[model samples]
Target chain A: MIYMKRVRLFLVLGLIGLIPIMISGCLGSKTSIQALFTVSPDKQVIPFTANFDGTLSYDEAGRIVSYTWNFGDGTTGQGPVVAHMYKRNGAYKVKLTVIDSRGRTSVSSITVQALNPPPTAQFSYSPKSKLNDKYVVGASEWITFDASKSTDDGTIVSYNWNFGDDTVGTGKIVKHRYIWPGTYNVVLTVTDNNGGKTSYTQQVNILGGPPCNSDISGGDTTINGSQK
Target chain B: MKGLAAVVVLVVLMQVSAIAGGVGLFAGAGPGGAALGEINQAITLYNRLLDNFNHTPTITGNVPPIPKMGSGITYQAGEQFWITDDLALGGKIEYFRTSVATAGEYQSGGKKTPISIALDCSTIGFVLTSGFNFLHYGFTLGVHGGVGYYYSGFTSNITFSVPSGYNKTISVHPHTGKGHYNNRSLGLEVGLSMVYPVTTWLALGVDASYRALTAPRLVDAHGIGLDLDGDGTAEHINLSGISLQVNVSIKLDLFR
Candidate 1:
């Protein structure tokens, strides 16, 4: 009788030990569903002046999550905020999807565009090398022209009006066209590839004739010079 | 008695004739000188060989096997003799305390018992050996070998503790157990001792040897003990095993 009673008591204790485990297993399945996924910047289109801040979030009880960013390029990307590069211009798309613990899913997306930038511009001027010396009114002189050495590394090549006078033009050279002349300043204006422009002016004196003359006799030979 | 006497006289006469014959074999002065030179050469060769043998250390080949079954270590004491000039010899005796640790585990039908024993053995021995110190190049070496009787034994006290207490403790009385279980063993000993003389007579010498024990193995009889303290107990006995003796001696060379 004692042996039988001991066996029964041992079985009862074993069963008592298993009760809490079964109860906890049943309660574990009823937790609330949660969503999980992310948004890189949280907000939409990022401005060049402004940076984009993105984030990722997921429902605690959710599963089967994915990300797709439209970047507005008609191209699509998947997997988180993943990657983004903004160099020149245009809008980008940012998307996020989260599945809840119950297998339900939700998606969020935003567009980001890059700002446009201004074009750069620069200018340079050149003068005719052929006529480098002073000119005189009603007087004519001949000189060689060279403009090959002048250059602007970044500016665009453009031409404007050339004022014909004793003033030398700083623009690409043409044949000299001076009629009445005096000490006159020469001016040149050039626009660069980006539309930036600058002008330069310089002065040269024009005289009608030589200022003095002299007669010389040597070895029975005579030479004569004249001045205006 | 008369026949025996005749035999002895004949032997003596024969020996005398042999000696005379030897002397006459090279009697001419010229021949005698040559023979004398040859004798001298032979003597030199013998002396050189003797010196070489004496200068070299010797070792022994056979060692007696003695089982030391106790917690205390066992050791050996020994001696080597090198007889050369004027008879010289060296002796040494050593005591070694053996390691005293033993363990055994046995299991029987789901029951196990582990047993352990330990002993610490330390050894100390000394050598007082000498021999004919042959002089060569300001150094001396001796050639010696002799026969001697050797004996050794051991003792140990053991107490058994029974933790189970069926019998908690047992007291063992000391006893004088084995008497020279193997009495005196005749051993042939050979040794060579080389001495680098730091002085005319005082020299630092080392000897090596080969010794062979002829009969009655001593180490085999060590299991008996003695009750020297008279507490009526005896533990272990007669455990001297084959021992190799190598010794260095400070020699007082008889003749410079």
Candidate 2:
């Protein structure tokens, strides 16, 4: 009988030990709010905008009233669902805070690896054949445009050129003749393998006529080497 | 170790029966300084590796206490034979040991991973020594030198979660390895001693010695040497040390 009483006392003590856990669980459920969110478009580059959804988050015994987002780059927003765009290359810890009708709040966070920087676009232009004091192109001389110096982590596809002379051409090296002597903005656009594009621009001076004594026409000025 | 004891006993018996002037069994204990160059290097290398690991951009946690191994105690047991009134020869076995350990954990990403590393080592030497005696003012002073056969045992332990250094960050993974690794080498020593013979059959003495012994490399039972530093070359185990001991000697003729 003493052994059985001792067993009963042990069982009573074990039950007493569980009282705190049970009470805490009961108190916790009244204010428990589970905050969950999801983000998509796992791979991104500069200027990437991601969609964050928190509508699936719910409270155990109440309803969520407000959803606040911390975009991790010193920026924030409010909504059950929203879109956030990162202007830089970095890993962002996107956090969300959900508050229930009773003012109970719960927070959830996720880290995202975002943004591959855009490729740098660069090019140098020179007058084909003879040069006058360098960088000085004859009005009708074929200009050699080289974009080979352009670099990127990915391959550079499609080199687009705008001669600013009402004439445009494609290819890494294109030749163009200015119909009249003038200064014009020349732009080179390089598209990378990631389908992202960057452009470089420089002013070109075309010399024609006057005391400079330049006799050249804008016609039949196709460059040698088949324009590559 | 038992075999060594047996060899010493048989040698003692043979000497005692063959015109022995004196035969004595002696034991001593003292502090010893070990020159464990390779083992120390391994410890340093392990710490540097851990520091590099924890320095990674994504890894973080409690950096456990570092591991250490320094000088330790040594015990000696031997039998000596007096070849002449002025010279004595002896055979002995010595054991020396040292080590330290630590345990902790590190967290990477969402997982908390336990981490630990421990190191310990020991060496047993079988040596034959010869001492010359000269009496001055009733105190005997002698110079001694000996050759020894040494065996060294080393152990390494490393524990941590894998799938780490996710980007080929840590070059050398200091992993848990064989519980024991061992190798053997020859040793040589030279020292000085002073003794006072009491009653013509008993004596007390003090000896100071310096030993040079290197096991070259230690390997597990499968003959695999460890390159804990990832230096591509196996570590060199140096057992060299210096020690001072006080001993007692009882002449065998008293028993005869």
TM-score for the first chain in candidate 2 comes to 0.49
lDDT tens readout by residue for model 1, A116-223: 332222222223222445333332322122232334435435433233352333334333323333554544455545444555444434445432331211011111
Tell me the TM-score of each prediction against the true structure.
0.23, 0.47
Measured by DockQ, the strongest candidate is 2
TM-score of chain A of each: 0.32, 0.49
Error of 2 at B178 (Å): 3.6
Best by TM-score: 2
Q: For residues B206-244, could you state the per-residue lDDT of candidate 1 as single tens digits?
A: 545433332232232544333322223332222222223
Per-prediction DockQ scores?
Answer: 0.00, 0.01
Candidate 2 chain A lDDT trough over 10 residues, lowest sum: A22-31
Clashes of 2: 0
Q: How does model 1 fare in lDDT?
A: 0.34
Q: What value does the lDDT take at residue B175 in candidate 1?
A: 21
